[model samples]
Target: MSQIIDTSSRAHLLDLFLGLRPDTLSLWGKMEPQQMVEHLIDQVQYTNGKKIPFLEFSEEEAKLAKQKNIYTDLKIPKNVIFGTLPDQLIYPDLPSAIKQLMTELDDFDLYFRNPETTAIHGAFGPMNYKEWIIWHSKHFTHHLSQFGLIAMT
Candidate 1:
C-alpha cells in the first residue's frame, strides 16, 4: 500500500502528483488540480516545525486520533472538508505547484535531523517525524483518490 513510509513508496506518492494536469477533475469538492496541489502544500508546510500549534484535538483526543489515524489503516472519509479551497492558483501550473509541494515535503529531512524535532498537526496535536510521515501517507491517498489518480482503498 502507498501508506507505507519507505523511500520507494514516498517516491511513488510524488509520482502520483506528476500525473495531475490542470484540467483534471476532482470527484468531489471545488478545488482545481493546482488548487488541490497548493492545498497539499499548505498541509505539508506545518510539518517543517515552523507553524504555531493551534491544536484542534485535546491531549486525550490527540492520542485517540493518532492511534486511529497514524497507527492504523483508517481512511479519511470522502468529501471531508477542512475548508473550501480558493479558486486562485498558487503556481501558474500544476507542475509548478507539485514541485513546491515536493520541496516542502523534502524539507522535513533537515527539520527532523535533530530527532527531537516535533510539529503540530491541527487534529493530532504535536507529532514526531514518523507520525507525520504516516499522516502524510494517508493524506496524499485521500487527495489522490479524490481525483481518481489512485483507487480509494
Candidate 2:
C-alpha cells in the first residue's frame, strides 16, 4: 500500500517549503510557489472556521467519497482549478506564505479540540479534526509533488 508522508512531520515538511526558490517550476498547474502556498493556507482554513457552503455530492455520495478518501490511498487529483481565490498574491513571498500556512495548521488543531465541532468540505461534506488532518496530509503531498519536492511511489 502506498502511504502519504503525513504533515505531522512538520520540521521536514517545512524544510521542503523553505527550499522553494522564486523561480521554482511546477511539474503541472499554473500556481506559482507563493501562490500555491497561499492556496494551501486557504484550503486549510476549511477545517477551522471557514464557511464554504459548496458540496460536490449528496449526503450518501459524500459519505462514500469520504470513506474512499480518508480510509483508502486515493491521491487528490492534480491540475484542479480553485475559483475561490482570486489572482491576488496575498503574501509578500513564499517563505512568509508557508509560515502563515503553518500558523493556520496550528489553529486547525486547536479549533477541533472540542471534537464535537465539525467543518464543511466542498467535496467531502462535513469532517471532524482527524479526518481533516488526513485530508490535509494528502492535500499537502499533492502540492509538494507538484513542485518535485517529493515523489509518490
Model 1 pairs in collision: none
Candidate 1 root-mean-square deviation in Å: 2.2
lDDT of each: 0.78, 0.82
State the weakest 10-residue window (summed lDDT) of model 1: 1-10
- Candidate 2 regions exceeding 4 Å error are 1-3, 50-56, 82-85
TM-score of each: 0.88, 0.89
| Tens-place lDDT digits, model 2, residues 6-98 | 776788878888878878999998877887898888888877675455777898899888999988888878888757546689888777888
Q: How many clashes would you count in candidate 1?
A: 0
Off by over 4 Å in 1: 1-10
